[model samples]
Target: MSGHTTTFLDGLEALAASPLSPALEETTRLRLLDWLGCTLAGAASERARLGQMLASAGDGPAPVIGTGQTVAPLSAALLNGMASHVVELDDGHRYGITHAGGPLIAALLAMAHDPRMDQARFLKGIVLGYEAALRVAIACQPEAKLNGWHGSGVFGVIGAAMGTAVALGFDRVQLNAALAAACTSASGMVKAFGPGSELKPYNAGHPALNGLAAALAAEAGFPGPEDILDGPHGLIEMLRGSPVPPGALSVAPPYCIETVYLKPYASCRYAHAPVEAALRLKAEHGIAPADITAVQVETYGLAVHKHDHTEIDGPYSARLGIPYCVGAALALGETGMAAFSETALNDPETLRLMRATRVTEDPALSALVPAKRAAHVSLTLRNSSEVATQVDLPLGEPEVPLRAPDLRAKFADLARTAALSEARITALADAVLDPQTDPRTALSDL
Candidate 1:
């Protein structure tokens, strides 16, 4: 690969071979904890229950996050991955526009079942997995999303395969073959978000299934195009409609995982900006939802394209509707899980505000995407007074991260919702954060 034509695998190889710094390791731990909380919380959902049924065929030694069930490694990976993303509370990368942790960590947990896996190796696997997925997604860039392809579904298989290869101690050649196999399996559509959105989590689940299958196939001496990611009709070219850009996949330090945004609210990441803007206006002006005459939200193009819906059919749909999120945030002073609950969905006041909301694209803000996921909100009150607020980024982004206490509280709340004892919750949190803790023993309680 040439200077500007650095391929995704080239970047993946460099990232895999690089030394893991303390900061990278720390970020891995945080991501693990975050993924765990999301998985546990979502485990109770009907979508997760359906996933569990679909994956319950084989028996093996892999824990299904909050279900306290042991299934085959591949099944566990699929179930946990789906559960983690069902609530839309998983960590997201702005540049990649994908949720890496769902597929990557879900596969890693299943791989960690091996007695051979240690804490350092587990952490390294996560970093490499995130690097693999994020690089591929970055290479695809705006084109992939523009084509209606979901990054998590398309790139997640790569992430899961890369991380699993690390845990299995694959040589470079095997890893390349595995990635090639994964590339062939990549598929997802944005239509999953339109209606009957309960199937949305399947996009997250299938990555773990296909990725593990690819890595295992490669491990068994299966062969694939070694240059599948950069050669003729490679994954990047097919997804991006062009050759890889210069330095598109060059090795950079402080890997993508370091900057992943954790979702403080249980809705789509695209909706968070509007929700934050609405909440800010509500907090600043002390205007009740009933007093609001109209609500307008201006955001990036992708956000408007994907989330402008106001006709929410259920909680899942509500989570994707920017209008519902902003209206709910203003009406309830919050946009957490409660805002998407059945009760809130049926609330007359929330519906009234949702109907009054309009979401439009701001070209200036749209140009800043993959760098700044921003939104601006303007609320007109009963007295014809106007209040406005702009949010450059939602909370839980690295720059506007949740405080330590807040992170802990989020974990605790999610665990409790999953029916985990307070003691188990605390223990799990401590174990995940401690570098010395054994991956197997730390999760014994679960």
Candidate 2:
């Protein structure tokens, strides 16, 4: 048993020391760009404003993303993580059901603040963090989610620790300790949905802070149970409330980050397929919102279970509601930030459409989950006409990846949405997209 644990830790350490392929490095850069766009766009939110205020009060070496403020490394990680996730547009993995980039990148930036940190090393850390954290998430998901736990708050902490360990050059022992310590603080609840969804960003922030602290503790000679990830009562059993699945911890991969999806809508990932379905119905059938009598949506059980609500209290609530997202997409032909704005949320027509929308679970679709985020949408018209569409996978999934030009356009739009000046947006874009740029300098100037 001890040897198994030792082998696991050694494998992780070796992954950290391994070199990334050119393709993997490119993907890392894109993920960074995506995270930066999300963080910068989210900086305008009240949550990010509060985070910046809290971090600005403290002084340290780490730069808080989307702000000119500097704070302690931990504080920076918390703030950046919060900002990145606040907009609900961060990149996410389908199988793991986790947003790996937000917290992992937050931790990496916090630890890579030193001018001497190599850009290659920082990028490698990003890749490693996603691999490790997402693997844990894959091992615990659906079950953990069904148990009311959020993977970002749980598995994300471990991912952050692994990434930080790589950045800080921690040995296998220290890495193991860091991971073990992270498990102690792994927690977040799915009840944060609906009107309480505004608190969801804390899942990313809390994990980023805790994961960084865990790695730092290990670096400072603190001891922890190395087998906390796989031993008795370890994170797998604790989170899943069952025995660890066989081979769940295996490191074999073409890089799990490659499978992560970049969000095309500013709503929960569960809502994406439905939104796409609705948009297709509107565009192809030329069905106006006024002409639609009612809508029925069938999707995977997890989506229907988590996002079926129509009673939206605010922007955050709107993001979590599949009914609202589908309604907005049908009504406005889009589900970007504008769809959740005060005017849109309060629009009587949109609300009426939302009320008329119904969501249900299709067992076939449910079984397809973690492999395909399929959705079926049908609309009945005032004239008794019917239109239907089914999306096996929404845009931005690995199979339907967003084009580089489109991704860059998204970044530019988000930067402008954050009220960034033209020059700053250009500079930030250049810095993030260029592999030769110093990460510390690229991050600090924002």
Candidate 3:
């Protein structure tokens, strides 16, 4: 085997042997549960509507979480993925700068419904999916944030394909074919962030569908190019504007799981630093919205792109708007799904505060892109007592994880919006904690 193949096989072997830690397992389960809840809550969205329409035209017995409709595995993956991410509340990987949870979870759930699959193998598949996705994400990190491609979809398909291949018992050659097919199918643009359109969810869903297609194609003896990543017109050469790094095509040990950052809030991870700083300012010294004279936010280059919203006016706008998030955090002490409601977006007081808040891209901060993601917040209070707080590391990072209580609280808060009963929530949590339990049962309850 070539060095690249050796690297990938080594990573796969390590992943196959790695036992799922209780904390990591629980975190994964919570993320899936949260995704299902959010999907159900946002089932009426345009993305969901489109997914339902597309699913109606497909075949099979895979379950669609919120709608409780049975469709083909590919269709279910697409629909559920779309539903989970339509509202932009799904879990994200800070280091990879992608939402791996949506596509990976969608594919896992679809496989979970398969009678031939076992829970242990299913859980392993999830870990492997995350490992592959994060590895590809980091490998392609250079173009991910800079070139406006949604890494979640671009790298997510590869993860889903790997998981699907494992679930289907594909050998090395078959896995390679599936990987190549996935690389060809991967695509998503960062423009969705700017507009916050239905395309955001589509980006999430497309990867699941693409992965399924790749695996299925590989199963049917479909041939794939051996040098997919290294080809002249391949992923790196065509889309990234740079040559693929030597040996980058191979995967390796430790995976990206070690560097993955879980999220504390449902909002964009890029907006978290400012939100954290605002919350600290409010809790530490009793800084109220009215007491704030002006707020300045300095962030990395990608942060500016992720949160920049000077022309947005709708709910989507508020979600991606750094000024809006910072303003809302300052005024309400938190930024949740409810905080992005139309009424909240149009609130005169909130708008005033948003206008007062200014965000600029600092070269020093921008220089830390894709590595040390950091943010600095400066607030000039009405009393002229200026307070500045800088968050070098946001909460939910691998080093600074949110506690179980924090995760439970966030899950409850989001679930409450969907009107899920306490009993149902507990049952879901139970299912997540027990890897032996069927995850589809937990999703079905949602």
Candidate 4:
């Protein structure tokens, strides 16, 4: 357990034998609900066509979410992982600066459907997976980003491995092997965040696929490096240029998923504050798109660093740009799923506002990173009037949680967008919220 990667294996293996905490279980259930909505909403996008095609063709045991198709656990995880983050509304951990749910939950649910796994095992696996992924990301952070690696794709492979291994009931040695093998399988391409080429979520799909393969291979008696995280060219040294911290692998009650933020805006997590600020200004001042002469967003490092695309030609770019999100929120009072379509990306007024908007990094905001993802927005009106606002935490953070009814409403909205019937939506909600019910059944209906 004192060994580098062995610490993660020991912590997860201990958690696997323990019963699920009631609070953590409820949080996981809600997260599963939110992840499902995002995945279904994204599944209908043209961006999801490649994964859908693969799902339709890769026939296996696990179900491929919306299309009524079944693929192998690995294939199902791959497709679901891609589709879940296509809309950029998945659950994110602020501390990790990464999304914990999309790839982790995608892999967990794929294995949970195997009938051998019960609700308890499935929930515990999710908890274990989230902890491993977030700790790895946090340990490798700032450096992982400085090295041009995407946290979710790089650390998420390890997270997916932990979850999949637990769900399959792997022993400590097998779990360690799975994680060690997954260490080399990590892929976090920062270039995928570019506008036209939509590989952001597709990069996530690789980890989900690779993780499942690692766990299965380890279970099949495959051998791998023992101290994958402590060796000379290990994850911590190679990725973060440091030794792995002992405290990162230590377990705390409630699990990491309880600390994650459920996204309200369908944009980068960094842009969420400005979007909230813009909406606040819109509500208080009734500012229309045409009435504004200039819009400027002063946010943290991750928000304004390279997210300066004022011209949004597609959904991926639209989701990544602070200008577009702030402009859309201020002008339209919301930056929900409706603001992400091809037509919405090409909207004349939206483009006009985007062109008028500028984003900059505020030192005060940057200092608040891994704590409160703060941002300040100042808007200049046609009459030369200025309005400014700052948000420390956006709508759906742990401090500012979405109400149960509102979360239900959000799920309904996404479900209706996918054209689900009223009855089906209700059934879906019931299955996810009720921990007694098997989540795979709810997914089957999706």
Q: Give the Å error, residue 156, model 1.
A: 0.6
Q: What clash count does candidate 2 reach?
A: 0
- Candidate 2, residue 376: the lDDT equals 97
Question: What is the descending lDDT order?
Answer: 2, 1, 4, 3
Q: Residue-wise lDDT of candidate 2 within 1-446, one digit each (tens)?
A: 45334555666777777788767777888888889999887877654466546645477888776667778888888888888898899999888989988999999888786544578778888888898888788878889999999989988898898888877777777887888788897888888754564789889988999999998899898888767876557778777888764666777666778889999899999999999999988988878899998999999999987688878778887898899998888887768878878889988888889999999999999898888989999999999978898999999999999977778888888888878888877787777777677645777767
TM-score of 4: 0.96
lDDT of candidate 3 over 334-445, digit per residue (tens): 5777677767777766777788877888899878765667889989988788988888778887668766677677667666666778887776667766767767566653
Misplaced by over 4 Å in model 4 are: none
Q: Please, what is the TM-score per model? A: 0.95, 0.96, 0.91, 0.96
Residue 49 in model 4: shift from native, Å? Answer: 1.8
How far residue 59's Cα lies from its native spot in candidate 3, in Å, is 4.9
**lDDT digits (tens) for residues 1-446 of candidate 1:** 33322355566666666667766666777788888888888887654465547465488888887666678888888887888888888988888988888998888888777765677677878988988888789878789999889999999999999888877778877887888889899988888777765777878888988998899899899988656777558888888888865677765766788778888988999999888888878877778888999999999999988688878899888998998888788777667778877889988888889999999999999998877899999999889989898999899888998765777788888887778888988998888877677555665446
In candidate 2, position 334 carries an lDDT of 65
TM-score of 1: 0.95
The ten-residue window of minimal lDDT in model 3 covers: 1-10
lDDT of 4: 0.80
Q: What tens-digit string does per-residue lDDT give for candidate 4 at 1-446?
A: 35657666767777778887667677778888998898888887743575546735556767767777777778888888888888888888887878878888888777876665677778778888898888788778877887788888888888888888887788777888888878888878787776677788876677887877878788899878788887569887888777765666566665678888888888988888988988888878887778889988888877776687788667788888899888777656558887886667767788888899988888888898878888888889989999998899998888999867878888888877778899999999999998688777778645
For candidate 3, the lDDT comes to 0.73
